[model samples]
Each structure stands twice: as structure tokens, then as C-alpha cells.
Target: MDTQQDWDIYDVTIVGGGPAGMYAAFYSGMRAMRTKIIEAKRELGGFMRTYPEKIVWDVGGVGPVRCERLIEILEKQARTFDPAIVFGQAVAGMNRREDGVFELTSTTGERHYTRTVILCAGRGMTQVQKLDIHGANRYELANLHYTITDLSRFAGKRVLISGGGDSAVDWANELEKLAKEVIVVHRRSEFTAHERPVAQMRTFAKVLTPYRISGLYGSADRIARVALTHTETGEPEEVEADEVIVSHGYDRDFGNLVNWGLEREDYGVSVDAKMRTNLPGIFGAGDFITYGSKVRLIAGAFNDAVLAVNSAKMFLEPSATDMAGVSSHNERFFEKNKAVIEEEKQRQQN
Candidate 1:
């Protein structure tokens, strides 16, 4: 006789653990729904993990805070409902039952049961673009870095950064005072980063526009010099550096979710005003979905999450409210609110 727990069927399963997915999990719990989150990566934050040090001031009511700190806060909020979180599973297969339940299979063969699916897998399974030069991988363990894990690591050391996007410029600016020298190499003279940041980076870093890294020169395992060639004239130049950073970009792989017959455009999946995909019980938020008036920002992703979660709730119960009640008056927060009040009172008394 086998004594085993029955398969758990969630009211909604969110794909991806980024801001949108995290917020959806919280909102769904507020609506009294059983929820789960399946994340491809071992951790959360999604694309934001790439720039953990960047200051994020755009989030409403959030004074300029580091992105990594915001991620920690968001993760805590997502776990408020104690939803099951599955990590390091890339969703590859989706099977729907006649009774309307969905069985999602990961590439590793794990299965999850859910009544509704919300794809917040922004830049699903992103692969960082590395330096394409031959033998570049040799220095990766030494002085070559694809992403900035610690800005202080380059303190007092010369740093060479390649790319023209916001991340590249941001890195250059951040390392300006920390590093002995900051060099920015880009294939195009016109930077794609925001105008102000680009201008700010130009004031300090050694800007090599319309040029690209051609080769890396070093001994043993660490890169000591970088060969750069002009994009138009092919003029070559070499610069000595103790560290090399590549911020080219990332390649996105949505796995097999794109094959589920969801209407999609070149940018992302198509969704209605209520964040509902054409398929019933399926929704999208964050960078995974596109509509006529999509706002590509963190705050925008939060708005999408609310709409998507509410849509899923209404799908499960047709008579449900279009949105959750304000948190200030929400009964679910009554105890939590009291706890906070008590803590504050104790602090004041002390």
C-alpha cells in the first residue's frame, strides 16, 4: 500500500519570478487563490539581475534604491502567501485536460498542475552575450567579466567595457571613480543608452566610439591589453587594461511556451485590455506580452501584474471583482497591520 500525497493543483501558476510574476503571486494570494511560481533560473529578479547595482528610482513611492535591494523586498512580498516556488526548471511542455486543468512539464521532466497560467517570464532564459573573440574564454576566470557582480572588484584597477547600451554606459559611470581608468568601446558612435547617462559617461571614461574589440592580449590566463579596430577605417589600436567587461546584451529563449498557439508579435505575445491572452485561463504580464499601450518600465509591469492576476481570478469565478480592494482596507492585512502598529508603538515607547 503506497501512502503518498495527491498531486497539488494550484489555482494559478506563474511562469518566471521577475517583478511581474512576483507581484502576481502576491495579488493572487490576496484574492484567496492557491498559487505557485515556476522559475527557470535558480534565483529571482529576471533581467534586473544583470544590473543589480543600478539605482532604481522609477518605482512608485520608492526613493532611489539599489535594484538588488528592491529585488529582495519584492521576493519577500511574493512569499507572503507562502506559495510554492520551483526553481531552475525551464518549462517546455504544456498539456491541457478536458476538465480545464493544465499540466506543465519542465525540461527536467518535473510536472506542475494548475488551473491558470501567467507568463511573466521576461527575457525567458536569457543567455548573456560574451566576447566573440577567439580564446576570450581563457581570461574569463581571470580578468574578463560579462556581468558586474561587484563594482569594488575593479577598485584602482583599469577597466575596459565594451557595448553602447544602457548597461554598458551605466557600468562605465559607476566605475569612473572606483577604477583607476574606465574605457568604453562601442562599434557605433551614437550610443543607444539614455541621453543623460551617455553624456555623463562621456565626461570621464575613455570613449572609443565607432570601434570594437578585435582581440585580447594577455599572458597565461589574465588579459593585459585589448586590440580595438575602427568600424569604418579598420584602424587598429591597443590599450592596456587589468580588467575587461563585456555588456553586449542578452539572447532570449522563451522555450516551448511560444508553441502553445498564443497570438504573438515580433516583440511579445498579444494580450487584451485585461491582460488576458487569446487562450482562456492564460494571461501575460511584464515584457512577455505586448498591447496597444504597453509601458516598458518597472511600474508598468506592476500595473500589468494587477490586471493579469485579477483576470485570472475572474476567469476562475466569473462573478469576482475586477480588482483587489485597496490594501489599506483589506481584511487580509488586518493582522499584519496590527503587528506593524504594535511594533511602532513599542519603538515609540522605548
Candidate 2:
């Protein structure tokens, strides 16, 4: 494992742990650059972690992969480079020093210095909205959850999903197959989710509209039922439930990056074709960056990562190769995995 003392300065410091950041770490390793990824969340995957059960069909080279599975594969690919990964830390501030190195400080007081910085901090800081019921906090440790990590946990249980957004409806649809009974409670009469999924969810799950969870009722350790009130009629009803999922969406902001002196759009930072920000020695990628005709897809973010990493590499060392060649044909691949490659080669020869 590479430690702070192992290198005087990192070749690249990636500011996010999403798909773009993870791929950048891998590519940086391919380029033999010392790399570190700092993520604000306790785990990697960024927004993907929120809806781990969601099926992803847009990512390249994979068909109908789950969000959690994609993240697992991406994380494994990133680990090949052994990049130093720091979780639960948010970049609080950053500055370029006279020595031509960038210094970064995290909210936790951790400091990192790197030759070049890659801004992959997608949507800056993000947080899931929580259930606002009076006693919801008491059951949070037990049956109440803001995010679903495992679908099996809901098996045979009665699940109550709150909210009308895409994630809420999606989870309701997914949990309907695992749970004994699934009920979707929304404050508004109409759902805000995409029409197709919402229509599909209605076919499997009981949809309760124009109603809000008025009160949570149960033991201190777990939730047993909830009281719902009609949004307009103010009529009350009770529903038996084993678990409640709050998917009110997220409260995401650009956070400290808004004040970082970089050119900004209403969405995020602005970058050029090379993924270079207005600041030298700094680049941006993924959902955190804005450009003309940006696709805002995982594949597009990956392209951004490649451009950013290559630009940063050349910026740091003008003599460095403009881009790392194909991994299958690159000498660095064999050099780094000599034992495994040799073993595979011998197995093939036999």
C-alpha cells in the first residue's frame, strides 16, 4: 500500500470516487502515476450507491447490469493500480502553491499534495432525503432505511416506500417481488417519476397517492405500522409494514467548489475539450463538469476521465507520453503483472 511518505507528491489526486474517478485511478496506474482518490462518502460509487438495485443499461460493454454490480466491477478494476483511497473525507479547500504543486485540505483536516488534481466530485456533495415522521429517527437503527443495500433483507416483509420520485417508484417495483406486500405512499396525487416505470409499478405495487405519512407507530427498536393522512381530505388510515424506505430524493449541491474560483455553470464546473478547467494543473470530469453537448452518461464521464488524466499528465511532465497505449499491448501491463502474466502464458503454452 502506498502511504503519504512513499512519495513526495502524488501524480494525480482524484476528488471523487464515482465511475469517472475510479477509471481515472486505473488509467493513472496504467500510466505509472502515483494516484489517490478522496471520496466524501463512507463508501465509493457516489450516486450509484443510493440505488444499488437499479438496472443500468447504458454503460458500455455490459448489458442490464445492476448499479451495485457495476460499482463492484469498477472498484475491482480501480484496485489494480493500488491507488490510495481515502473515504469519508470531503475536500474543503484547494490551492496551487508557488512550487507548482496543488495542496488540498479535507473537512476532516486531512491534507494532500499532488502535481495535478482531477475534479470528479460529481454534483459536489450529495445526501439522501430522510423520512420526516415524528418517530422515524427511533426506528432508523432497525427497520427504517434511507437506502437499500440488499434486496434479500426485504424478503417476506411488508415494505412501505415513501415518495413519488423515480427511485421511490423503482424501489417499490423491485421490492414488490421480494416483499410480501409493497405500498407506495406519496404526498402528491401524481408521481414525478418517469411515466413508464410508474405505470409498471402500479401493476405490481399498491399505489397510495395524495397521502403523506402523518405518524410512525411501533416499538422503539422497530417500526410496525404507519399512519397516513390524505393530503387534501385530511382523512387518516393505518398500514401494517415491516420496513419503510424513504426515497424523497437527494439534496445535492456543488458545495465548496462553487467558491473555488473555477468557471461554473448552473449545474457544475466548466471545462474545455481537454477537460482542463480555468485553473492550470486542475481538470474536471463526470457529472461535476459541464461542456457543450455533454451527454451526462457513465460512458461520457469515462471519456472525460481519459482526457483529464492525459491532459494532467502532459501538464505535469511535458515529456511524458500523451496517452497510455492499449493495456493488452502495453509493456507496463506485463511489468506490473509479471508473475500472473507468466503463469497464464505457461498455461496457454501447455
Candidate 3:
């Protein structure tokens, strides 16, 4: 619990409370590191909060787990290590000291000192791109949404989604079973998403591409029609709809972290095989700091946590070598925390 005006030192200070950050915190605890996780949200699980009803399909060693269940499991795993958790605190700035420690200053003027820093912010700090169309602002609050969290509300309703990426296709597929009619419009001719979800969506929904959403036609209570444009001929058309979902990716605001001498490429922060950034004591993992190998999946980010934690351990103890041997240590750590893990599993089942 770090309040403003007092500087509390920790072994590692992890930014963001997504899957990557949560896993990093768990590993930090396993290594017996005094860690603190700083999250902007009131609770843990970043985008997991965005898909409460969606099923998580890619988590390895796990069945198609519910998003809420995954969140509970990850939260429990993160806490099993007993790391000091800080929520609703956004990092305004950060700097690496000459002594190799990282100093983080939050928007609330809270300052944290730690031997290492791991950023797992993901795309949470970014702004969700929207279809800048006529009458967009009116429905922006009432009928328009940037992300999908729960699908129950969409059942028996007509939904129009804009975008051709994995998100748009995934949502289209998910809503197909629930919603009355699902329509997906993409600016690009070809979908950039994986073939599986794309195929699934095409089986049920109307998939149109190389078209842009031009305007919103609706009354005060709900959205009724969506104006669209053909990319090739500039032809315009309108489709009736109940709700419009825009998912064209996002733009990030790294904030003053850009001034902290952090090593980041256009993709994200750069880190080595061990998740060690260019700065010795400053490390990054997950979507925020992957160098060349960027896997946006939660499972991939969890692997990044393994590397980052190992690197943090070696950095704290310079005499350490062969961090590969830390795997047994990790197993022991998980074993010690098995009771909590079992509790979460039961909760998930119940």
C-alpha cells in the first residue's frame, strides 16, 4: 500500500494488471522478491475485464475457460506469491537511477523505488479507434461500444460490427449464436484474422469488406441504420441495425515513460530472450515490451513473465547463474500455493 508523498522500495514494480503483469507478479513472489503491482483499474485483469462472458480459447493446458474464470485463476495465482498490490494508480513517469533502481511516479504523486520494472500495460493505455462518421457522437454513449465484455445483452438483437481484424471476427462469431443478425464490415478486402474464426463467422454472419462505415442513422433511444461506403466504386449504402461496434485497434499513450530512457521500438519496449530490456534493471514483458517476437496472446505473455522474472532474479543477485534451473523453484512455488489454486478452480466450476 504505497500512498502519495512516501517512497516505498520494492524488489520489482510491475506496471499494468493484465495477464502479463499478473503472471510476472506471481513469479516475483515465487523468487521471494518483494514485489508491488501498480494498476490503473480498481481490480486486477486488464482486457479480461473487457470480455467477461467470452470464452478464452487459447490458454494452454486449459479447456475453453470462461473469461471471468480465467481472471479469477490468474488473480489467485498472482496473489499466491503475496506481492503487494496497488490499484487505481497510473504511472505518470518513470526513470532509471544511476544506482540501477527504477523510480516510478504516478499521477497521484505516488513514487515507488524498485530494483527492476516490468511493464505489462498491454494496449490498455491506448484509445480505441472509432468510426468518425456523421451522428457518431450522439450514439457514442448510448448504442455504440468500443469493446465487447458481455454478450448476454446482445442476445435477440441485431448487431453491426466494423473491422476485419480478429476482434471483429471473433465478436461476430460469438454474437452469431446470440444476436438475431450479425453483420461485419471491414475496410480491407481480406481479413487479417486467423482463418478459423473468419470461417466460423462467414458460416452465419454477412461478411462484407473493403467498405467503410460512413454514418449513423438512429433516433435518441437506439441506433437504427448504418451508412456504409464501397472502397472500390465509392458507392454508398445503409443497413438497418440495433447496435454498432467499432474495433479498429487502438493508439497508445506511453506518457512520461517515454522520457525515462526506456528502450522501445514502434511495436513496444525491446527486451532480450530473458525479457531484459536495454536498461540493466529495467525489464519489460507482455505486449508493452516485446522486441522482435510479439505474441499478443495471454499465454505468450505468461511465457514472457517467466523470462522477465528469471532476468529480475539474476539482476537482483548478480552472482546468480543458469536461471534455467529456476524452473524447479517455480514448481515448488506453485506447489506451496496449490491450496489457493484449488480454491479458484472450485470457484470456476461452481
Candidate 4:
């Protein structure tokens, strides 16, 4: 079948639709390159989707807004130039042809052609860690939660959270006021969370250290109480709970990407100051790649995207401008600015 993907070879293709990938797409357009984004998930936002209800205030100019709202705005900006977006496809292989175009093949056998590739596969297809206790899966739909997507669901209910990491402590502290009671169970005496949050969590939530959820006692797929076992003493106790939250963390894998020979560390793949990876024509950005003084925040990802996109442009044509002009100097950007102004004016008039 003849398709646009078959005939059109993008100048740059971004793998992963996180903040880095989204900004890369927009910046590539400013550099006048045909761009495409390949995301494994059905939607964008990458790891940010895990914390939709969380309020984000650190994305540079963006004010305090829900993570979900920021995702919407980023997606809107990513589509500024109408780049091709391929969803539900993970690129499992990359091969550069003699013609100089890179061929990317997904696990589903779909393929994309591009001149340059930007690796933005943050955490490399992260999978949420789940409860290991027997029959725990049965109560997942009833009350068990791996991540807190909605806060309203726990209104005025007894909530028990497991683990001692930042997420566990943070959630327990937040749930203290809303839930009838907040119980935090950790297997270690010392929590791995920040000292300030841990101190705050101890102020309200019922903290149990060196303990574990040995068993879940529930009826008909609903947890009524949880049996706790002390790791050191083996003493057992039980706590009643209306809801159970596990912050066991995630199991991340780069899948076949690790075999591509990109220099990587425990944190992520290695990239130079210019965001260039070990593989030529293949750059990286976001938390997927690490460098000296690299920041893991959303603002950091945007900065990396700009550098990677500019490097990709220069790689394609050495004579191309070192950087994209500012929005004021970009001639075609005026239409979008005018449209935004008009929309704001309309809102004001209404």
C-alpha cells in the first residue's frame, strides 16, 4: 500500500514523546526540517502521565498547573507545525541505509525513514511495579493503587501506603488530612525520602518501620485488613485499611536499544555537551541521556531538546545556522503569535 510514511522521509524523527521529544519536534520545525514523532504509548507526556493530578510549577514560564494540563499544552505546542505523530509503535531497530537515510523498525513490523534520529526514550518504556503479595492483584480494581492518579477517590477513608521512598512518604503526608487515617509501612528503619518530607510525614501519618505486608486479608476482591511482619523480629500485627497504595517503584528497560552500542551508564545513555551520542546521526536528550551537570527536570529537557535539534540541523547541513532565530526574527512564526493574540483578545471581549 502506498502511504505518506513510505514516500516521505523525515529530516528528523524523535523517538519518545516526552517533554524532550515534544520540544525537539517543535524546534526541528523552526529549523525548517520535516519532523516525525514515534511514541510507544497511545498518547504523549511520557512518564509525566503517571502523575497527572500532581501540580507542576517548574517548567520555566508555566505557572503552577496540573501535570495533565501541562501535557495538553506541550502536545498542542508539539503540533505547532503539524508534524507526523505515530502512536502505539516502539522502534525496536535502527539501520542506516547506503542512501544515508535511517530505517527504524517497530516491533509490529512498521517502519519509518529519517535522516537523523533523536533518542528521547526516557526510562526506556517504564513499567509500573506492582504488589507481590498473594491475591493482591484481585483487589487492584477494588482498592489497590500503584500510583495516585486521582486524590478524590480516597476522600475520608483509611489509607495504608507501603514503601519508604519519596513517593510513599509524599503520598502519606498528603493523605493524612484527607483520609480517616494514614498508615505508612516501611521495611527499613530509615526512609529513602528527603529529610524534610520524612520529618513532615512523621508528624501526622502513623509510621511503621522495619515492617512488611506479609499478607493481604480481604473478602471478595476487597482488602479489609493487612497483616504486617516485622523484618527483624518476625513479630506480626494487622492493620485495617480501606485502601492500599504501593510505591514499589518501576522496572525500566531499554529493551533492544541497549544493543545499539550507545555509551550508557547506570543513570542513562551518555551524550556530549552538544547532545551527541556515541552513534553519529543519533543524538539524545531528556533523562534518557546523561552528561555533566545534566538536570532531570522538564526545563532541563527543553534545553537539551534545543541543543539536540540544533546539532541535528548542523549534522544535516554544516552551513545551516548554528541556532534557530528568536521567535521575533522567525518570519513564519508571526501568524501563530497573531492567532494567539487574537484569541486572547476574543476572550477579553467575551
Measured by TM-score, the strongest candidate is 4
- Cα lDDT of candidate 1 equals 0.91
Error of 1 at 18 (Å): 0.3
Clash pairs (backbone) in predicted model 3 = none
Candidate 2, residues 113-232, lDDT tens digits: the string is 899999999866887777766557888889898988888999999899999988898788787678998999999999999999899999889888899998888887888988999999
lDDT of 1 by residue, 217-249 (tens): 989899999999999999999999999999999
Clashing pairs in 1: none
TM-score ranking of the models: 4, 1, 2, 3
Runs off by more than 4 Å, candidate 3? 1-7, 98-100, 134-142, 231-234, 291-296, 319-350
- How many clashes (backbone N, Cα, C below 3 Å) per candidate? 0, 0, 0, 0
Worst lDDT run of 10 residues, candidate 3, spans 1-10
Cα error, residue 214 of model 2, in Å, equals: 1.5
Backbone clash pairs for candidate 4 read none
Query: What local lDDT does model 1 show for residue 347?
Result: 100
lDDT string for model 3 (218-335, tens) is 7884688888999998999889988888889877676766666767787887788888877777777788876666788898899999888888888888776534445445565566
What Cα-based lDDT does every candidate model obtain?
Answer: 0.91, 0.87, 0.82, 0.91
Q: Which runs of model 2 end up more than 4 angstroms from their true locations?
A: 1-6, 336-350
lDDT of 4 by residue, 71-166 (tens): 999999999999999999988998888778888889889988899999999988888888777668999888999878899899999999999998
lDDT of 4: 0.91
**Segments in model 4 whose C-alpha atoms lie over 4 Å from true places:** 1-6
